[model samples]
Target chain A: MTPASSMNAALERQPPRLMLADPILTMTGIEKSFGDVRALRGVDVTVYPGEVLGIVGESGSGKSTLLRMMNLEDMPDRGEYHLALPGQEDLNLFTLDRFSRRMLRARHIGIVYQNPHLGLRMNNTSSGNVAERLLMAGERSFAVLRARAKESLDASEFPISRMDARPSELSGGMQQRVQLAKAIALEPALLLLDEPTTGLDVSVQALVLDTLKRLQRERRITMVIVSHDLGVIRTMADRVMVMRNGDVVEQGLADQIFQDPQHEYTQQLVHAKL
Target chain B: MKLDQLTKPWEAFSYGFLDQSAKREMRRRILKAIAIPGYQVPYASREVPIARGWGTGGLQVTLTLLKPSSVVKVIDQGADDSVNASSIRKFLRRVSSARETLDTMEADVIQSRHRIPEEKLREDQILVLQVPNPEPLRPVQPDMSEARIMHGDADYGQLWLTLYEQLVRSGRIMQGSSYPSMVNGRHVMTPSPIPRWDVPKMHMAANLTILSAGREKRIHAVPPYTRVEPLVFDDVPYRIEDHADKTCYRSGVTGFFMNELPQDDGSSSFEVSDSQYGVKHIRRQEGEPVTLGETYYREGRLER
Candidate 1:
């Protein structure tokens, strides 16, 4: 057999996306660099439909860089990104114009940032934050907006009494709840979380993590989460990808990676976690 | 008055009159604007006899369609004898032999500033509306090219966001004039500085409406039987000015748009905005027969 053909066969069997006929997102040969420094080098991200994929790495390891590219927020210098959503099958997101890309992101993809200030507008009421995306997607009915905002906030376990309260007026956990409520308000096909609970204290982080897990399960949403917290990756992710120095070192089922890590860096990470 | 984005600055004026070629050029642009409703068509705006921004856009249209047999009525802020309306009417008569009248039904062409005629216009009439700003995206996107691209792509999320922010801050939409409306379900056009009450009159109306901006050098049209819907949320319905309960003192007419005249002792009085309409009301009261076209509003609510 030709060497390149053999390698292609081997690579095809690697990600679980190939096992399933159609994946929600399939990215190949993604590369991004800043001047002389490479943030991501030849990264391939494959996310199956309705599966949770976790990316774990140390600081400056390009875990967040890879996650950002999934949402088209930070476009890779070169890559082919094909995504499938309901009614829109296999759209090449990388080649879309800015206007269409923005519309697609608004109507299809939902993103949650680590900082509540970045994710939720601090001045707007909690319900306003949740309703902003719906409004942008052309939902004009105030009664429907109110009901849907209440439904999302209630689903996220946010207090119904504080629906009109602003994000700055709430605690960190409650603010994260609002962020979660807004991200899922549209019921987007894909959700990307970047260090969702990193800024909170340990107790608040646990509360926020619990809320995130419940929402993810109930919605059955396909997700790609980037976190340095191994416990989060262990409890939440179905599969895990390990990265170091702008390259993915190891990836497999979450249980296998935690119990018997294949790479030395992954073994160090698994062993270092208490 | 804002010169920061003048793409084609005014180079010269030709005695404030349009030649036959200029009129033909305007006809082409008007036809294009009508063909693609609500899309702004750029044109060479000639400096008319009046000062800039003083209904020169509407005056250009009036001059273009001027004929000795044409009967023209000019109204500003719903008043026939207002300074702006009177000057434009005298100018039209002086330039051409066209007759001037304050009666809405007698006029073949009506050139207006701000408000449409209170009397429902007929299919035979054409309404020339003077526009100060043609770009509805000006508030959200300041760059002309960027605004053009937004219009081309029909990306109006920022406009909705602005309205949402305003609603969150205030109790209602504070946009009182030039209500941005969706024309032909495709392009969002500013219905020229008209009040919210007058916007619904253009939707599926029999009369043709042409909006033009001189200083901005842009023109758009809403041909007969087109949809002109104000941008509003379904649950948060569009509310017009609250003038239903008020009555006009001069003509004893109630349930029409009124202007609140303040008194010296912290009081107010109501006057009918449509001055000629009020005159007709007084003439009828005096037993002089005057035909009043069916008003667009009855009991201060638009029938359509």
Candidate 2:
């Protein structure tokens, strides 16, 4: 075997660390472009198990693109993407075929879109929308479907009575809760949230954020969140990555990043937020 | 390059409005559904000109099986002449040029929404029942993936408990339509929105029944002679709607499903819910020779 591969093989044989030895996700030198426009360039991010990693950037800063790549909805032009699933070795995501990638996304990764319409089926009941994901994962019994959906919705602090209401009938905050319920129904190992509280009112945003924080704590799953709002990142994320013009400028612990920003752009963002 | 090679001969539309590939896919799924009786088989339900939830499932099945010589019957709540039924019938005719019949006995394929025919369906006939919600366990198990596992394990304890609770509270099985029934002692299927009376017709029946839900993207089947037993305690015998004794005021047909028409007075008059059967009765009374097929219910009671 080659030197690097032999080292990797040796690393695989070693017993996994009991805690924080390996990250759940590792993306190295990820490069992506849309025609002539470069969306992401040499981006690298690693998130430990159960850690909430936040990506904060202005619009068109490649935050959404990188988030989508984690779920394999968007492919990087070049990168080494490795995801270590629970009870499994780190999988080289891009090397695996398309079907395997989809199965992985369906079973291991849960994504909450910025727009609830993109994630929630508007015509189906809120519970039904959550049930759709469970059904896709091969659930068929109505009894278990209802019970599990009720539990997830209850976890999000959504009213039990409104579980039967369609997403169109719900308030914006309630719809986001429904989307969260849908994503987490599979009990995915990785949760991705994109601007989950962007469009809601201040009070509603708090309610949604609180519910989300509770669920994350209760589930204890790895999370990667993308947002333009630094306050959201500070509230929920353990680590924050600041990006600009399709490149990450700085990344550190959430507190460290806020207290002492090194990059000029990050410093400007911090000052503006304060 | 010849003209024939450049383009095919002019035609109004494909045989079933659905292209050949779509029809082929439907045929494959239908065969699989029939083989695994009462098993909900998934399919890529294609978009039709009609809306998604409006009998599109039954329409797709009918279109797949339809031929120029096949006689088609479409019914909405037992009425062949209702706007929805006739409109579907017209659409089928426009696409496939199949013969349209109001008589259930003469139809090779019958697509129905929410009800089954009063006249007994024959062995050769195929019943395509439109299902709004195919998952019978939806009320009990809202998560479909878990529901599927329950089906695989044949775990229906919760469903039975639900019935028991209903019986304890209401003193009767209060489920009005889409009564859940066990097919072939295996899967419990929602027999579309068919009334309780029409459900027993599926048990040890001579016709093949296909239940499809377009929006839900599922198709399940019950073949001839398959056992379809409704969920019930052995002590409390299964009961249908209490319309066995009511007579149709218009057709003078007694001992069949009836639609109660309320009058300006405090009372209500009843008419046969099966519109075509009533029409046939009216015509036969006027000296038109029409043979009414044998029915599942004889003299207000279902005959085994």
C-alpha root-mean-square deviation, candidate 1 = 5.7
Candidate DockQ values, in order, are 0.50, 0.02
Question: Where does model 2 sit among the CAPRI classes?
Answer: incorrect
* Chain B TM-score, candidates in order: 0.94, 0.95
The digit string of per-residue lDDT tens for model 1 on A50-111 reads: 88889999999999888777877778898788887767757668888888887888888888
TM-score of chain B of 1: 0.94
What fraction of the true Cα-Cα contacts (under 8 Å, chains A to B) does candidate 2 also have? Answer: 0.00
Query: Per-residue lDDT of A63-134 in model 2, one digit per residue for the tens?
Result: 999999998988999988888776776767988776677768878899999899899768667877776676
Candidate lDDT values, in order: 0.84, 0.85
Best by DockQ: 1
User: Candidates' TM-scores?
Assistant: 0.82, 0.59
TM-score of chain A of each: 0.92, 0.91
lDDT of 2: 0.85
